[model samples]
Target: MKISNETKIGVLTAFAITIMILGFNFLKGKTLFGTSHTMYAKYTNVQGLATSNPVMINGLQVGTVYSITTDKNMKEILVNMTLTKDVNIPVNSYATIKNNPLGTTTVEIRLGDAMQYLPKDDTIRTETSAGILDAAVQEIRPVLGQVKNAVKSLDSVLMTVNSVVDPNAKNNIRGILENLNKTTAGLTESSASLNTLLNTQTGALAKSLNNVSSFTGNLANNNDKLTAVMTNLDKTTTNLSNLDLQKTLTTLDATVTELKASLGKLNTTNGTAGMLLNDPKLYNNLAATANKINVLLDDIKTNPKRYISFSVFGKKNKSEPLKYPLPDTLNAPYIILQK
Candidate 1:
């Protein structure tokens, strides 16, 4: 039988609607023709969990979140999950809403070892997991606080520096840098001069080094002479060391003492020499006797006949005895004239 165009259009539209609804439900993890179980969980916070989010069991999606609602007092969030898979969930199993940092939120079911299974529409234990962002924030919170404190300390230090560094201080610092540069320049000049002074061909240091080398060569050539000299010096030192210096010094000390005693006697009137040295009257008398003897010798030399009469003809010539000494006729005289 041929249908009307309107009726055919209506049938197509109905089929399209049915297909769309099935797709929508399938995308929501709902099984319209297959068996599915619903479970409920209560939480103080859902952590941005929404409907149609996957429910995972060991990384496998077994269900989806059906709906989310608040309790009568609105003190807690109640979430219903529809399980699409036939896997048994223990009565002691717990469900957690996992909030991801870079992805969608979900419900994860952790199974317990209980033999008994949870029935449909039953309440499951609920827990909330810390999101990656939340955990990172928790880890970084203390570090952020420390960074803030460090920034404050740095700001305070900068303020202190700003207060301490003035225009005059800046000038002084510049002057110090200038002086340091001058010192560096002087050091460079000194280094250049030192290099010049150490030149191998022409420098004073080189000349001195050559001289020293020559001296060392001469010493090397005279090694035997040096050794002989050193031996002689050693023998001399040995002889000196072997000498009885103490006995010599004792004898010298005794001689010096005797000489000192003799000198002391001479300084006093204890001996003839001392009387001659110390008594003026005896000294004057000796002087007079020496003068008279000198005059008699002079008179005898001048008048020989008065002292010795010797004649073959018995000549007796009379000459007045020299009461006073005649003037020395000869320039040569042995006695010192006393006036």
Candidate 2:
């Protein structure tokens, strides 16, 4: 074998190419030199994501970013990653960036939620999230502005609050509080007399209530006796109503029967009440006797001298009228007729 110079140059060029390919694959934690399945990812910004950055699936580096370029037409950076064919990433997995603290570049590619088996050499959906430092810087911008505004306004608020807490003003407030306390003390003193008067009235009210209780107890005791009397009266009235002895109807029926029997006995002609009750001939005789008595009384009323005769032999009429006139005064006459 003749070691020629041209052959040596050709061999070194091939060796350098082999070394570059191995280095690219070694950076992705894959075999040094093998056929890497090509896959692509798109990111919003790939400022520091280099071609040699390792692509890790679940914290295991399995690939490297093989190429990175911003497409002028799409206005998004294209990140083409060379992944080991043995490494499977789920289609729904996410890609996030990792960078150093200086925030100058990102070189770490991490896969998240990579459980599903993706296609060989498939272009997975890309996402670009800022590193913690960059997010912190972005977040701090608004917060720092608020701090600057607060610092600018603090002096005026301090000045306003200082006036309220001043020692002289506190002393004046203390004096006003002490005067109000003295006025409250005077009112408390005045209320002591009112409290005493209320105590006296309370004592009198207790005595009056005691007297009323005694009177009410007496009334209650007497009410029991009164109730007993009323009960007895009601019992007496009920017994009298139910006995039937006091009813005049019973006696009246018996008296009516007995009187009917007596009337039956007396109804004969010789009976005393039967004459008035049934005798028409006796009524006629009584009527005739009444007629004689009426005639006699009428004759007495007409001429009283018919029942008597005047005897005046000692006194002679010395003078007489031409016509003999009846005496104005009827003289007592001797009885000549006897009934």
Candidate 3:
């Protein structure tokens, strides 16, 4: 059968329109053949939720967001979710709008513990979760403030450095660097000298080291003698430590007290030694007696016949006793006058 072109054109246009309607409904999350139930949720803000977004139950996609609308008061947004007929949501179940990291939003349904289920078209509770971008902004806020403070601190430090580095300070720094260079050169020379002094063949340090080594060797060889000497020293110290120092001190103190008493008696002229020391008359009499004895000896030497006339040939010379002390010319210089 040959159809007319006008009829064919009309049929094709109608089929295309029908296909577009079906596709539009599908895109809007309307089930074409399968059965679904509509559930409602109200929120102050839908958080960018839109129709055709997936509706999830425990991370499983069970439905889609059917529509979003505002109430008559326009203070709240009402969301419609079309869930599969098989999904039995309990009473008091809630829905939350979730934003994915990839910038997509979904409606998540939470089941309640009540045995009774919510009827279709009933409005469930709604909540909004913080998106990744919002959370990131929240976390970075303090860090941004800290970065800003660090920048300010850096700027302040730079200003301080600029203020401190003046022309005089620069010259002083240069001078210090020059002095440090001189010191470094001097240290290098000293190091070389030290190396020379440490030479093993010809250096005094080597000779000193050799001497020390020899001394140590001698000490090692005399180790037994040293030990004996040390033992003797220990015995001497022990004997000294064992002496009765307290008894000696007590005896010495008694002797000192006796000596002090004797000295006190001597100073008081109460004893014979004290009288001899303190009486001037007695001292003068003794001096006189000694002078008389000395004069008699001088007279005897001058006239030997006065002492003995035993020799018959010798003249009988009568010598009177010397009334005063005769100054012996040989011994006169040895006399000491008593004041």
Q: For residue 101, what is the lDDT in candidate 3?
A: 58
Q: By lDDT, who's the top model here?
A: 1
| Full ranking by TM-score | 1, 3, 2
Instruction: Name the 10 consecutive residues with the lowest summed lDDT in model 1.
Output: 326-335
User: What local distance difference test score does each model get?
Assistant: 0.89, 0.69, 0.85
User: What's the CA error at residue 262 for candidate 3, in Å?
Assistant: 1.3
Residue by residue across 149-247, what tens digits does model 3's lDDT show?
999999999999889899998899999999999999999999999988999988889999999999999999999999999999999999999999999
Considering TM-score, which of the candidate structures 2 and 3 is the better prediction for this target?
A: 3
Give the local distance difference test score of model 1.
0.89
lDDT of 1 by residue, 1-339 (tens): 989999999999999999999998777778979999898999988888898999999999999998889958878998988998989899889998888858989899999999999888899997677778788999999999999999999999999988999999989999999999999999999999999999999889999999999999999999999999999999999999999999999999999999999999999999899998899999778767766776788788778887687776767658676666556623333655699
Q: How does model 3 score by TM-score?
A: 0.39
Clashes of each: 0, 3, 0
Ranking by lDDT: 1, 3, 2
lDDT of 2 at 217: 93
TM-score for candidate 1, residues paired by index = 0.40
